[model samples]
Target: MKKAIIALALLASAGIQAQDIYTPGEGEGIIYFLPKTQIVVDIIATRVDYKPGEFGLYANRYLRLNNVSTRPETHWEIKDIQVRTAGIPDSTKAYIMKLKDKSLESNIELTDQGIAKAINTTSSYKEEQPEYKLQIPQKHENAHQYMTEDILVAGSSAKMAELTAREIYNIRESKNAILRGQADTMPKDGASLKLIISQLDKQERALTESFTGVTDRTDKVFTFTVNPEDKMSDKVFARFSSRLGVLQADNLAGDPISISISNSSSLPAPVEDGKKKKKIDGVIYNIPGKGKVSVSFQGKIKWENELQITQFGYTEVLVDGLFDKKVNTRVVFNPVTGGVIKIDKD
Candidate 1:
């Protein structure tokens, strides 16, 4: 008898453990929809404000059900979520809250006979409706300077819209937090610039191939020349020019470079909105043995005089022992344009 009782107790414990395992079922909350579920919600409104004592800015967004009609009301469920900002500077923190105190009410009327019949009839009804809210907080000394009003929810799978929304919110929050901490000490020069240049080189190389062949010369010196006809597009040129400007602003003693645009051919047609797209041809030259570098671009001008103005863009550079150091550099057409330009080396 004692052995039988012990065996029965052991079996009961195992049965409890088996029941603890997770399984999907109706009316089981958001966790029930962990596998093969589809949900769609539209944004209703968003509110953001600074929470001074808490050391962060708080944002609250409300979403409404968009696909509730596809599934039975009792079968709908929501799961856990994460959130983050798209391109903001600071990291944000997100929390999900369930509003249990709210309820939906409906009005219906029946005649005297219908009311008496409904009282005698027994029917099963499940109206399990719930509202959820997500709270996001961002921490930054200058959070207001970079706050955005837009929120995006990217789905994990085609069916996991609610989970995606939650995840995106958490991601944005975390990114904002990281940015808040690192924004002040972000690198202004040196390796960052080097990496940017390296990436640009790789991208340019992928777009076009460079040919190399040894020239038959008796002298020990080796020389290479890049033709301007292989220059990149105007947009690429503009991007390089902008980067150079940023470098100059950061380091005035840095290498000096100039870029100009000109179109010496036919006059361009005026745009429909009274704007004209000017076609320009420019050259970036590295002057040997000279401290000064010049960039020349020619294009048609509406000016009273010259049909083609050779706009001279000049800057002073410190090229001391640059050639001897073998500082590898490559100038390619802007990826936006297919025009090639000259690349100079000592």
Candidate 2:
């Protein structure tokens, strides 16, 4: 009879233990297991906006654990956290604000699945209520914003696994000088281990960024110049000169201007002996007072393929009698098309 009673008590205890097990997406808010930990966490955020060129995320978390073992009661504490930006290549620009405690450790892990899980689980978490609002001048035309809060709870066994994986990964891939050789040499439960793990997380974040290819390309050089006075001499030159001078001072203050010039003649056929023929259509010049001068050539010539001008001209007259003049005297000719590729001021 005593043995039956003891068996019932043990079964009841096991039932309680089963109920205490933490499962991903089981509790309220955004809570998930950290690889191999018994920690249960809840995360909440509000007014989160996901937009191109503009994004904002605010989150808060709470953590706790249930003691179900007969051994010395164990307490679980959130020692650190790891947040990742996943999927979209450069979507990690949004910064975490007001980290609860600076002394708390943090890391960024880069498994392909880590980000995907976070994003997918985001919808399961509840949005947090707003505490306050501030009036600020709007900078972007269409900027969206939001706020959030969260909670996290974990168990002792799970927490141990989290620590173990972090240690192993740190020892293998971490680049921190202090963590070198110390992974195996340091006391397992000491503060040094925590510090090393924190550094490892930071290094992981940098590695993820490198792999995402988020660095902008800003080293390419592009340069071109125009001449407004070339090939202009008569009424055509006067009108164009006045228009360009006024446009530069008003509409073209910060704009790219397009210039197009083509020959108005045709080229003759090639002669016998298989030698390539040459054709001169017209000469384009940059005369300061004449604007742009286009002298047409005679005969049936292929102007597009033969006679081409190198330099164009530009002129800007100032109200104080100071003339702002620019000339494209250097011509980059394309041999295949017999055309000008680029023109610049000499």
Candidate 3:
């Protein structure tokens, strides 16, 4: 879709009320929207599952494996946490740009959400959502895939376990022989020798895992969106359990994971004058306030950073007469923070 000016109307004079410039659903002019910052938290957790081997009971006797677990088990762990910011259109900050001259129409640029990105200059804003992905474990080969014909067709579980253990030892011996350069027929190169040893090690591990069991792991991401207007202390956003992994905040299955926000804005608090203050009439933009955000789990801080929060700060406007036909002005805005990036006039 075309992304720029929506509608335009010539203003009679510059003495217009500031409220008229931003009042919703009013005049026919270029309707543009300001942006608000949204905090995104991505939690990555890993789930581990262990499957007991079919011949686990005979593992200790045949392979000398000690304390091999015969029961299946499942558990979860928090691997990582990532924080990012996204911009969304703020309906309350929508405004209309009514200019006396229509010559600047061709130089305006805006995002799809009607957030002003640049005027009389090039902008690199691409209206796209963030990408998320979850990784899953791949299927692993079964012990039978690496078993010898005699071992596969063994009459009893005890015999099969012994035969498998012998095969694993054989693979290990072959790898050692190649590594020691004592094999009857050696590989032509170091790369070939490495490949042969790696295959042998893989086959040995598959055979051994049949007795010791196998643990499979997969990673999943959980996302939470936050919009902050003030300071927040120890707000529980999610939970984590060793048995269930990530859970909702209301879920009692896990322990609480919290987030804390502290406003660090340098802007003075707004004063209430007896007369009502009007919204600015000129090129309006935000002077975003700074804030520190942190995440904690299990009584320990995990991640923290400072970010620009559009809601914490006040708004300001460029001086009048900057957009006149006689002046050549260029302005670039940070849509995420609603703050001006650059301003130039010739």
Report lDDT per candidate: 0.22, 0.23, 0.78
What is the Cα-based lDDT of residue 16 in candidate 3? 40
**For residue 42, what is the lDDT in candidate 1?**
17
Clashes per candidate (backbone, < 3 Å)? 37, 54, 1
lDDT of 2 by residue, 167-282 (tens): 33453454444456533355366596677676555554332222121222111111222222233322111111211221231343322223323323233222369777442211
Per-residue lDDT over 199-253 for candidate 1, one digit per residue giving the tens place of the 0 to 100 score: 4344322211111101111111111111121121221111112122212213543
**Candidate that beats the other on TM-score, 2 or 3, i.e. the better one:** 3
Residue 207 of model 1 has an lDDT of: 17
Best by TM-score: 3
Relative to the unseen true structure, what is the C-alpha lDDT of residue 75 in candidate 3, on a scale of 0 to 100? Answer: 97
Query: Model 3, residue 269: displacement in angstroms?
Result: 5.7
lDDT of 3 at 183: 90
For candidate 3, the C-alpha RMSD (Å) to the true structure equals 3.4
By TM-score, the candidates rank as 3, 2, 1
Candidate 3, which segments miss by more than 4 Å at Cα? 6-21, 102-107, 126-135, 267-280
Candidate 3 lDDT tens digits, 132-177: 5666776666789899899989999888988988898888888888
**Which candidate, 1 or 3, has the higher TM-score?**
3
Cand. 3 TM to true fold: 0.87
After superposition of all CA atoms, the RMSD between model 1 and the true structure is: 41.2
